[model samples]
Target: MTTHFWLNETRPARQAGAPENRVYVRQYGNGRAILLAVHGFGRSGARMERLGLQLGDQFTTLAPDLPYHGKTEWYDDRYTPREFSRILQQLLDRYPDRPVFLMGHSLGGRYLSSCLAGLEHPDLRDLVLVAPDGAGGRYTNWIDTLPSMLVRPLARISERPRSILRLSGWLSKRGIINRYSAEYLKSNLNDRPFRRRIAGTLRSVLKFPPRAEAFERALQRHAMVCTVFVGDRDPLLHHDRLQSIYGPLPSVALHHYSGSHWLPERLLGEYYRNSLLTTVP
Candidate 1:
């Protein structure tokens, strides 16, 4: 059995100074630092808890539910990437001496950038993202482009069950998810709590303003070693756009693999140690 620690939402965002985000953290290894893992949209921190186990020999790991997602069961009326960044900062303030390795997937990657901006920690050394989001046009083929730009908007306006079913239908037809391993695909629906959280998260993004200023600020003041990983077959985001946003960083390196968007699940341990953990100095 794996040992786990639950961090309640008692951090500052809440009126009582309680953590606004609920975290499920598992400790591993003997290292002095921690890896803060954030999952992409429709996913919960619990899904990524294995990262801590995989890297436990080298560092402690904290996989936390983002606002409006998972155990947090909460949402900021005016949510933005900066809100997530500030929240992470509050959590890190408690462990300043230990180097923090920030790892995020997809949307989580976009928010992770905010968390790292303008922060100067001696031990804070590496930033890694897998199919990390931010750069536009990441998924460029006609099939992906049309849906991302058109269908996605329509789906947002569509009724819940109808939208989800429609989206599911579209996914089925495109065979976009065919490459994902059966095991990974199975896990997508295993966590009941996560399924509920996805509703609010999607709603927040559709309504919340995109804080481009905050994103730019973080990207520009970036002082950490950054590495990016994306699969060749992942639709919805293109590599060129991703590089356009993050490629400017002299310390950042981009790697491409022959996998899909869900590569993190199919190659969990491999991804943890390679694409993510490798950047940690």
Candidate 2:
């Protein structure tokens, strides 16, 4: 995997004297068709490297670390889906000549949907969404709302090492949070700067949840071949809701797998293979 950075001047400025927005991208393969894969929240582009590698033979897979995630510099007051989508649009512009395929998981899917909704790109040929969030709604549960409400205040306590350690330990012991989630949270707590940025991003997501109508509009207008894969047991998204949201669009096809939110490697690879062979002209 090779890392590259591009400075985006089109992104709206949130603060004075903020450095130019720099997008971090990981590239795989050297094929003519381009696959722009977007990772989910709390995850980096590295997570999608395997998917990229699997599809690399036929397509140049590019996974970008969205703002405030991975190496991408955070410039916005809050990381809104619209802003993330804009950044993706800018990234896609770099490869104007290549046939582009958009693939996103979870939050990335929401941003991808938002970005595709407003833009008309001739190079964009296909879209692949894996257990995406925001299909049903962004603020459908307290899990999303409570944290957003407390993000600012929690950032203060998150900066205190002892406070975070104690809270994490308590939450883990009571099974209020899974061990992996707890550890991830603890790591964020120790990193004060990252914590602040994450808090702001959370607040922004809560304030501006993805609109289903927007996604429907994008799907209708673009008329690109779209493949949507959702795990039957995905806790983050419901299959019925996804079907409801995407069923009406003739260009979109939805598939359901027997698994959880995370798609198994074998199944994912198979889908990618089918998508690459069938969609590429």
Scored by CA lDDT, what does every candidate get? 0.57, 0.69
Segments of candidate 2 deviating more than 4 angstroms: 1-3, 12-16, 136-188, 238-244, 247-250, 263-265
Task: Report residue 90 deviation for candidate 1 (angstroms).
Answer: 3.3
Model 2 clash tally?
0
- Per-candidate clashes come to 15, 0
Deviation in angstroms for 88 in model 2? 1.2
Model 1 Cα lDDT, one tens digit per residue, 70-100? 5554643335545555556655776888767
Cα lDDT for residue 201, model 1? 47
* lDDT value, candidate 2, whole model: 0.69
Q: Which has the greatest lDDT? A: 2
Worst lDDT 10-window in candidate 1: 136-145
Q: Give the candidate number with the greatest TM-score.
A: 2
